[model samples]
Target: MTFYAFAKRIVSPILKKMYRVEVKGLEHFPEQGGVLLCSNHIDNMDPPILGVTCPRPISFMAKAELFNVPILSGIIKKLNAFPVKRGGNDREALRTGLKVLKEGKVLGLFPEGTRSKTGKLGKGLAGAGYFALRTNAQVIPCAIIGSYRIFQKVKVIYGKPIDMSELREKKASPEEATNLIMTHIQQLLNENR
Candidate 1:
């Protein structure tokens, strides 16, 4: 079995039981096609929670440092995560992300670019916007709340897909696109209040 299949069948149950994960708006995820799933970063747990919550298989860009760790590399690679340099634009990582989308797979990203130690959303970095502009991939804005603590009742709300067709003809600055997507994510978080 594929790693995702293995995880979905085995690890998924454990995640759901352990965290009591509650997924809302699951219908929002498109049944098929390239999709960019953007979420507010709250903790290191967000990605795996999302992977288990999402109906489709999601690939991610993890920090390059994780890949170098003893034994963690095999596990992350098995989970469909590739390595990306932290704290800056990793050109190769960005390209790999684009390739995942072009191949019609779901690419999961934290537009805030890093875990929010303060438990508040951070301003989005440019990588998400760059990918959205280049591939025109449908963007799914999501918010994960109450995941900073283990075994907490975590909730994941998926907003409707954001379309970027308005920029199909015009060139959009990466910063502009990044804010646009982040705004949607922030809105989703606001509603949870």
Candidate 2:
């Protein structure tokens, strides 16, 4: 196995045990293939929580600023994260994400762009939708609940995959597609609540 794949396999279980995490809907993941995991962001821990809980290596797009710290940047890179500038169009980051998807790897994206302090799902940016269309990858809507509460048990609900082929065929605008995906994520959160 590749280094990241092996490291992810070994580290996830240990981290889950240490954190006392509870996860569901792992079976919803495709046994093998590329996938775009679109998740709600409530806290800084959300990414690692979802990453370690799922049974595969998830390549996530982190803010470029975070990588400026030498030690943390190295660690994040080891964990299969790439950087994206926060305030503008990041073509390079988008290209890397697409390349990962095209290579049949999982790419995790926070559609909200940043954490939601209120614990309510925020409006999603169109990047996830755009990536899905560009790569024709399956979009898996994930909802993470109770992650904002300190030391509390967290729940991650993975909804069924949404096919992007139809969206591409209809020539749906990124805004429209993003809204649809966000609505689905909200519905998943409601179901868990």
Candidate 3:
């Protein structure tokens, strides 16, 4: 099996058991096509939780610092995680993300760009919106509920793709697109929380 599949198979049950993870609304996910998967960032485990629960493999843009760690760097690379420089525009990272989507793959990203200490959703950065507008890929907004406290119920909710036809027609800016993405995520949080 591929590394992603292998890793998920080994880790999924462990994580599910450890956190009592409950994944909902997975039926909203598409079976094929490029997808820009956007989610709210709460904890570092958020990505892994989403990855395990998702039916498809997701190429994620992680903070560049994590790549500095030798063992973690190698592991995350194998897991299809790329490094992104936070607090500034990283052209290389942006290009990588575009390439993933153009190649008809799922590009997972945290719209807020960083973990929220308050466990509340934050305003989204333009990166998620940029991907949504630049590619033909559908934008799927997800919400990760509950802290990663051991034995606590952690839920991952995948919402339906945000309709971007109107935004595309208007040539909406990245900021505008991000607004819609964040709005859907917030709605999901409100509904699911």
Name model 2 segments beyond 4 Å from true. Answer: 1-14, 148-151
lDDT of each: 0.88, 0.84, 0.95
Query: Could you estimate the TM-score for every candidate?
Result: 0.95, 0.91, 0.99
lDDT of 1 by residue, 133-176 (tens): 99967899999988545677888999999878776458888788
**How far is 87's C-alpha from truth in model 2 (Å)?**
1.8
Per-residue CA lDDT of model 2 for 119-175, tens digit only, reads: 899988989888878876778889987744545667888888886677889988888
Instruction: Tell me the TM-score of model 3.
Output: 0.99
Minimal lDDT window, size 10, model 2: 145-154
lDDT of 3 by residue, 1-193 (tens): 9889999999999999999999998999989989999999999899899999999999999999999999999999999999999999999999999999999999999999999989999889999989999999989999999978999999999999899999999999999999999999999999998
Ordered from best to worst lDDT, the candidate numbers read 3, 1, 2
Cα lDDT, model 2, residue 48: 78
